[model samples]
Target: MRRHRRAKIVATVGPASNTPEMLKRLFLAGVDTFRLNFSHGTHEDHAKVHAAIRALEAEMGRPIGILQDLQGPKIRVGTIRDGKITVAAGESIRFVLSGADGDKTAIPLPHPEIFAAVMPGHNLLIDDGRVRVAVTGLGDDYIDAKVVIGGTISNRKGVNLPDTVLELSPLTAKDRVDLAFGLELGVDWVAMSFVQKPADLLEARGLIGDRAGLMSKIEKPAALDRIDDIIRLSDSVMVARGDLGVEIPHEEVPGRQKELVRACRLAVKPVIVATQMLDSMVNAPTPTRAEASDVATAIYDGADAVMLSAESASGAFPVEAVEMMDRIIRSTEQHKLYRSIIDASDPGEEQTAPHAVAAAAADLAEVIHASTIVAYTSSGTTAARIARRRPAVPILAITPHAAVSRRLSLLWGAHSVLSADIHTYEEMVERALGFAKEEGFAKPNDQMVVVAGIPFAKAGTTNNLRVVQVEG
Candidate 1:
């Protein structure tokens, strides 16, 4: 099932959509990629879901990408005596480093890194900002804080220190285990959370090697400070606006999201605008007008993909949410304004031979009114570059490597198909035309613009462009 829309949909798999029937429905509903959230499910649970996805892919003969989202260094308060407590504003509280039960006066915060890194005057947000506290004093084993906006504080509630960049690795022990499991499962992308600098990516790369594409989740304010370096090192970026909104001012999130999206585009790294995109759809049969507009806005901004978290994972209407997202993207792309906006934000100046050739193919497709732009790629980079052009025609990316075919699934306007590697120019054209016809992207006598590298099976050598007339 080919989607005419450029922007793709990423659906999370959870209890609500764990069954094979629901998984197939989501794939048919227009989910280009499946996100396996490591924070929630167990390894066994995720393995089952991964197996289901692969089964569906084999049944349908369509490449599907799997993104493993690592749960990085999530800080939270430890156990409380009564399980919860209600603190009034203007009250004082103590966060003890010792892992012990707490009363109204104090709570255990087992994460020593936070206590060691936090200083007086730094803000600590609890329970997703439901309760706010300002550090009044720091001790060797505890932090004295004054409640600024207090509410019910419960056991294991998340703690966010927006004012301080704790000296910590992005990966937790659980994340390392999860990463190894995901890599073993052969996931296409691994999204690292709370990445503060480019060095974080290097650490992940050292572990991941080339097993999967490393996608940096840009949430921390420190990450935004060194956005360029992070984008350069990472294979992709996800604008995780949930923690981001909590860390930065809510009003600044939209601008920051745009900046990150544009930066990733300039770097030619795929960017996913994620978190709360259709949060209302988690329960409601339909999304709010604002929710729909938020998705459309991301597509208009030339984002490669928009993601659904709870909306698809544990929502009452998973298929409906995916359909709504698909509708929103299609509607936005059909707007005359979208094309102009995408053109205006074009990443000018081709930096490599492959980039120049991809641009030429896009132009050729437009001039000839070709049915599709066929890209023969080994590592999927050539297809990605062509998709970045936001060409009016669909991009049919043929690859020999299953991983490459699956990874290209997330790229905008890319329709990936697995085929044997082509050796000669004639073989390339023959396979391209045959697959385009078989895939219903074109008919006999239709024209296509094909792009690829010269040396067969060579990666990152996409320097050839040709316009071919499909044989009758």
Candidate 2:
């Protein structure tokens, strides 16, 4: 089934939508891709979900991408003696580097990295900022802090240090194991969380190799300083605004999100704006007006996809949330403002043959009023370049690689399909024409702008563009 809107939706699979029947409903509801959150479920649970998704893909005859979001280094306070505690503002507390339970006077901050990285005056936000503490003194194994803002500090609550840049790998030990399992499961993408630098991508890439696409989760302030390098190194990026909003000022998130989306567009990398797009839909059947506007704003900013976390994973109304998001996107795209913004954002001069060819195909499609811009790609790069142009017509990406086809599903305006490798130019055109017609993207006598490389099956070699008419 084709969506009327260009932007895609990524729905997370969880207890609320893990059943095969529910998964199918979500797919039909307009979910372009499924996110397997490694942070929550067990390996067996995720494997089951993965198997169900593939089964659905086979039954529907469509390419659906699965993203394994690795749980990076998440630091949290250790257990408390009474399961929770309330510290009064202006009270002093000690964070000892131990794993044992503690009383009101102190608590265990078991992560050595955080203890090592933190310094005097650094603020520690606990339990999602409900409790705050400013470090007054630091030692090799403990921190003496004064409570700036106090509330209930529960057992093993999450800890966020906005000022400290811990010297840690983006992938935790659990993440490495999860990555191995996901790769074995044949997931299309691996989203590395809390990526602080470009080098964080290298280690994951080394492990991933060519097995899966690597996506950086941009959530840290340090990541913003190296956004370009991170985007260049990774296959794609996810603007993870959850931790980002916590680490940085909440007001700065919108501007940072716009910058990241625009940068990814310029670089032709698929970018997903994630975290709480339809958060309220997690409980309520309908989304708030502010939430609808938020999703629309992302589409207007040219994001490739907007993601739903708890809304689709563990929400009370998973299908409704997807349908609501779909409606918002379609309605937003119909507005003249959306089109004008997309048209105005130019990706500068073309640098490669594929870039020029993709640009020419988009231009030709608009000029000739073609039914579609069909791209023959092996690595999905050509299709991405065409998508970056924000063409008026839909993009039909025909690929021989199943992974490439699935990955392209996350791209804006890209409708991906897998086929056998074509060896000749005539075969390429014929395949494009056949799929365009069979998929109901075009009819006989309809014009199509096709782009591909001269040497078939070789990746990143898109250097040709042709205007072809479907033969009657």
Candidate 3:
């Protein structure tokens, strides 16, 4: 069942949502992407979810994008004595960051990388910002923190010391193992969490190579600090709102979300707005007015996707949340100014050549009232770029790789098809038009626009643009 909505819905799969029935319902509810959060599920469990989604896709005859989210290096304070402790402001509480063996007065920090990088007076937020502390001293194996804005500290609470630039790789050993599994399982996109710099994305790409597309989850404040570089390195980006809302001041989230989405658009890269979009719907069948508006805002901001975390993963109304999100997206998109904003975005020089060309094709297609925009891509960059434009017409992206096809299925306004490799531009155009016809996206004599790169422009070089009409 093809959904009429343009903004994609990403439903995170968990115990409540792993069933085939639930997966099908969510798909029918307009979930364009499924995110497998490695933070919660085991490989065996994820395998089952993966199988269920694939089966559902075949049964429905529609493509569903699968994203494997690697639980990046999560820094947390070690266990507290009695499993809980409370510290008052200006108290002399110390986070004895030696190892995971401290009591309530102090907690061990297991991440040596954090210990080495932390400097005195830096802010340290624990348990998703429940407790705030300032670093006071550092030792070879231990760093001490003074309670600055003390609050209740519980067992195994997440710690976010953003001021400290830890000398650590984004991928942990578990993440590396998960990356291999995700590749073998044929996941469309690998979402690397808490990505701080371009090197983090490059490393992930090195691991996945061309096996799947790399999507950087921009949640960390450090990532926002280096947004341009990270966007340049990543194939796509997700604005993970959970930790972002926790780490940064709540008032800043709205502006930040808009900025990130606009940045992604100007760069012609696909971007998703994620996390707790419909938190109230985790229990209620319908979302609160605020939640509905939140989802609508993301769509209005030109996000390629809006994601449901706990709402679709472990909520009482998993499928209903997806359905509600879909309804809101479709309704808001009716009078939405998405096409105008997308059309107005000037593809900057900062973007890659292929990205710029794809944007140009989308712009021209919108102006010409083309039936469809056909993209022949190897790395799928051109296809993703066109999708980012969010033109009124559908984007048919034909690629030589199944991985690329699966990944592009998640983007806004894009439908991916796997085709045999084309060695030349003529072969590329013929294959694209043929697939478009077979898919019933275009008819004979229908006009369309095509974007590609010049010879030797590399796999993702999409500097060439051509407009043609299909012939009988």
Root-mean-square deviation (CA) per prediction: 1.6, 1.5, 3.0
Residues 1-472, candidate 1, lDDT per residue (tens digit)?
A: 6787889899999989988999999999999999999999899999999999999999988889999999999889989997998998999999888867887666889887887789999999999999999999988898999999979999999998888988899988989999999999999999999998888888889999988999999989889999999999999999999999998999999999889888888778899999999999899989999999999989988999999999999999999999999999999999989889998888785678778889889888998999999999899889888877889989999999998888887888889898998899889988998899988899978899999998978999988888899878
Model 1, stretches more than 4 Å misplaced? none
Report how far residue 422 has shifted in candidate 2, in Å: 1.9
- Which of 2 and 3 is ahead in TM-score? 2
TM-score of each: 0.96, 0.97, 0.89
- Candidate models: Cα lDDT each: 0.91, 0.92, 0.81
Which regions of candidate 3 deviate over 4 angstroms?
A: 99-104, 138-144, 344-360, 421-440, 443-446, 452-458, 461-472
Poorest lDDT segment (10 consecutive residues) of candidate 1: 97-106
lDDT, candidate 3, 344-427, per-residue tens = 654454456666677678778888888888887777777777776677888887777766666776677777777776678778
Better structure of 1 and 3 per TM-score? 1
lDDT of 2 by residue, 305-383 (tens): 9999999999999999999999999999999788788888765756877788888889889999999999888999989
* TM-score, prediction 2: 0.97
Name the regions of candidate 2 deviating beyond 4 angstroms: none
N/CA/C clash count, model 1: 0
lDDT pick, better of 1 and 2: 2
> What's the lDDT for candidate 2?
0.92
